[model samples]
Target: MNRCLISAAMAVFFFFLAWAVSLRQALLFLVGIGLGGVLAGARFGFTTGWRLLIENRDASGVMAQLFLLGLAAAVCMPLLAAFPGELGAALGPPSYSLLIGAFVFGLAMQVADGCGSGTLYKAGLGIPLNMGILPIFALGSFLGSAQLEQWLQLGSIAPVGLVARFGLLEAFGITLLGLIALGWAALRWSDRIAPWFNKKLFIGAMLLAVLAALNLIIAGQPWGIVYGFGLWGAKAATALGVFDPTANAFWSEPVNVRTLSQSVFLDVTSITNIGILAGALWIAAKRKVGAAEPRSLTGTQWVVGIAAGFLLGYSSRLAFGCNIGAMVSGISTGSLHGWIWVPMAFMGSLIGVRVRRRFNF
Candidate 1:
């Protein structure tokens, strides 16, 4: 559990990835580690941020998040524009599924006390509830993806890419303006005496923005979390004969089929997801002994929390992604659905905070 030992293990894994996989995957693993460290070290919880804003009128976390989005977009949009052929955005359709799914995901994340990245990092940090929720979340994601085709039948328009439509400078300007506006609004709604900034959160936002940009450059795609979870679930289900990839519309695609056949370390998202876990574990190992421990939940609380975790996975798939994927990656890359996802998810968070309170979580 020594920091040096953890670093050595991470380095060994990095070399293994470079030797066995590609250099790109190895570098991405490093990026994922950076992301995990920032998220864990900063205590940056998107769910907690929204809940704080709702309950205590605190805007510091929300402002930090807005800064992260703006900074990430400033870097990402140009890179995407420069290498349009090589880089891809986290685009998702603005459909009924998005609305319903984002809302449900918002609610579920609150009840579960973690979003996708939040859950992963917290589990890595040895949080009991999140560790238990991880597999259930994967199962929910897999089931949700399996049923995605049906959700789309409710009606969806084609995805809109802002950089493609408005040009890089225009899209970047719009993204920055939107984030600034949101920050302003958060401040306006905040408690008069509430602290508007935190040094740690600000630093975390800057580091995350840089790391996220690195993830996009190395992976050739925006950073994501849920797809890896869904893939894990699919792999498990397929191995158990509980699911058939050929039968599921989403999994039947040639690309998906190929992905299913390959090792998870080869998958861009999966590699990063694993790296996040490892990085967070590294952070956990560095923490002072017995500094804090996760609170215990009653049996009923555990059941509700676990069920919410399942819903988090299912709704994230339906919503096209979670806080990290849909909101951060999507917005940073100029996807319109990412813009739409925020308000809906926030609305759900409003109700979610109430539900979380009712459950005394």
Candidate 2:
């Protein structure tokens, strides 16, 4: 896979999307490629970032994340406000499901060693553990979505949109302030001598923020990861005659039903996800020889890691999104559930990191 071959293949795929799907989907695929490239090239690992913060008191990764959040909010909030009719935000209810889901997702991600996007990019990079976990993650996501209505029935509240409730300026201000406060807290908790910034990470955050804004603009929705995984699982189950979309509350919706019948390339998230994979593959192909070999795991470690991947998928649906869907898109778009998702997931990560350590992962 030379760069020329990768570029040609991507171009051919883009033409297929434009011809068979729509130009918008084609462009989104490109955006997804950019996302994959940046994520893999920059080594942007949300799960690893949190783990580093917890285990090493390192703030560099966390701070880079905060920068990403803030930058994305700066761009996305305004677009959401201006195009309220055309664009939609990532909004999820504040529910018992969220509390439980986010916590478990955080914990599971730590053990699995990847969140939604992290898993995707790493899988694209041909990491054996993540590649193995991908299907299990999809299965868990489908199961979680199938049972989501029941989870909400336990207890939930209406989703709150800061932009809608507080107006654009106020919502944006609050988002930035919250990020700044988090950055301060991360700094305080970090090792005194630990570096606060890395040039590569900063550039990565900037590029990702811009790319996320592009996704929102082109797709008429914020960037997401897990929904696509769940959808893939649902499609597989339906093909196997093991699942009924009409019976499941989440999958029974008009839109969901329509999406199920259509080609996955027509689905916004799926196309982007595919693009991310392609982009990552491109990066992997171009890498120099002698890249570090993946670590080998014991049988028990393999079981735990794979099982954790399942939990990651299931919990992401319950949580309304993973780090990308919930935290980045949620907070950037002014959804309060995103705000609620953070601390709960962080608490889960606190426990997850310990479990990871216990297993010596």
Candidate 3:
């Protein structure tokens, strides 16, 4: 009963907020709420899912992600081509910043135990540590964004879109084949069938792909996570008079300037972010939510987790995304940067696991 009331209140609050902004904003918020529910109820998580494969060589979670990526790509790339500027892909410059940023993000997530979307939902579920991690993550995001322009100047290339370069047909085929190969690699490595597939989880991933596609269709761009967090932190800092957006290169960009001045709810990523957290909370209050088992950690572990959360935000800005935004949406949009992000992040994951073990974490 209490859960229902809380959910109702959140819904009302977001509705009014979104409505006050625009109907489109409201719709995006609704999609975000749906995303949160899907994430919580099905327990769809990119961070722990990747960790499972990394630590145990369990490929089930990775396989589902691949499927989701492939399906999203099939639907999204063509739409981007047809609509051109109206429908944007999650493209990023191929730069040293992306390489280093993604690698560090991977390591941080392993220690922090959540990626962008994962952290949002977990925090929404009221996990005490995750809740604590949220603000620190926001702070790191603000700092990272503040310096991002300087990093890009070091060495960067224009953003590439596979559909634009290869055409929709070719891009789709290549993307599908790549996903199939990735899925097969995951399958072959597992050496068993029993754990290879779960009908419910597989279906859940497929549905997730659909929702992701819907996000692109409605918002005219792919779903993003870290950008919203960064925006929030920037806004808070500005409000506190600790920072001046007018001087920050990244914030001073024409598009960003407008977004910062406007209500946060008008921001596509922010609206969805709010929905995911609220939806996750509603689900946790109603039924068993999807999450790994909890365990007690040492004081060292807690400190590491908190620090890692900060890194997760900072590194994600440098890297262009977390697991969902980079590995998932990045690949789905057929950006070469997405491909680059994965292998580097995976390498970080390997190192992260060993470091974690030393702490017995």
Candidate 4:
């Protein structure tokens, strides 16, 4: 019964969104649906993966994350370097912007109990807190983007692509080696870690990596989450006459302007984001996942979570991507900032976990 309802909902949504936009949008949405299913089913998540590694010393999730990065880098680097048109790399600069933003995002994710992708997928699964967090995350994303230009001016350097620094062969070689070492280290630390790979999760990880790479190929950019949220919020604010897209530096770009003018289905990331939500809902329901249990959000919990969501949004923009954009695609694309983000965010997550206990979140 649950599966049937999910399927029907997906079909109706696909038709309406497809009718409203292009076939490409429909395809992206399908990819998002797959991502939703895979994430929920496999228990794949950056935040949960990191948290498990940090708190429980379980390396399984982190190892899978590393594998996702390795495979994605192997596939995506070549395409980005060789095929420049349309398939552009997500190149974020290395600077204080990243250091500060990613750290705050790390902390916020812990407080909110979900990263960008985690938040979206869980909300789709009807997690009450995340359901509350999503809109605020969106609003925060808009506010973040609005201030992005000013933030970027704070001790930033131009984006550096490994392909540009070292030739394609060298770049791929370096990335592959780094991923290997990172994966090994993660497993070594976790006494409770399972085998090198789980058959079920391996397939899911590979599929996700491939889909993310395809996202780059089709959308002409790497997989990302926050931009779509920000765009949604900005659009809403504009509708309410509280904001103007034309004036904001972030929204003034040609591509951004086009995104603003068209239906959300026409926007690549947004298309996929909506897909992820619906897809996760479908899978969760099918798996007998209930809406976030009746845990009511207290006043303090709400304040903390909402504030954290806002920071997650603001910091993600300043840093150039969230977990998906900055960490996964960043390292895959061979950006130094991606490397920089990992440690900073990890340290922040450490702090966030401690803080979270206070709020009992």
Best by lDDT: 2
Q: How would you encode candidate 4's per-residue C-alpha lDDT over 73-160 as one tens digit per residue? A: 9899889878867577778989888899989999899999888888889898888888888998898889989988888888888898
lDDT of all predictions, in order shown?
A: 0.93, 0.95, 0.84, 0.85
- 210 Cα displacement, candidate 4 (Å): 1.5
- The CA lDDT at 303 in model 1 is 94
**Which portions of model 3 miss their true places by more than 4 Å?**
287-293
Q: Could you give the C-alpha RMSD of every candidate to the true structure, in order shown?
A: 1.0, 0.9, 2.2, 2.1
Span of 10 residues, lowest total lDDT, candidate 3: 286-295
Sorted on lDDT, highest at the top, how do the candidates line up?
Answer: 2, 1, 4, 3
Q: What is the Cα-based TM-score of model 3?
A: 0.94
Off by over 4 Å in 1: none
Please, what are the lDDT tens digits per residue for candidate 2 over residues 1-361?
5878988999999999999889999999999999999999999999999999998999999999999999999999999999999999999999999999999999999999999999999999989989999999999999999999999999999999999999999999999999989999998988969898988999999999999999999999999999999999999999999999999999999999999999998899998899988889899898888878888989999999999999999999999999999999999999999999999999999999999999999
Q: List the residue pairs that clash in candidate 1.
A: none
Candidate 1 has a TM-score of 0.98
* Each candidate structure's count of clashing pairs: 0, 0, 0, 1
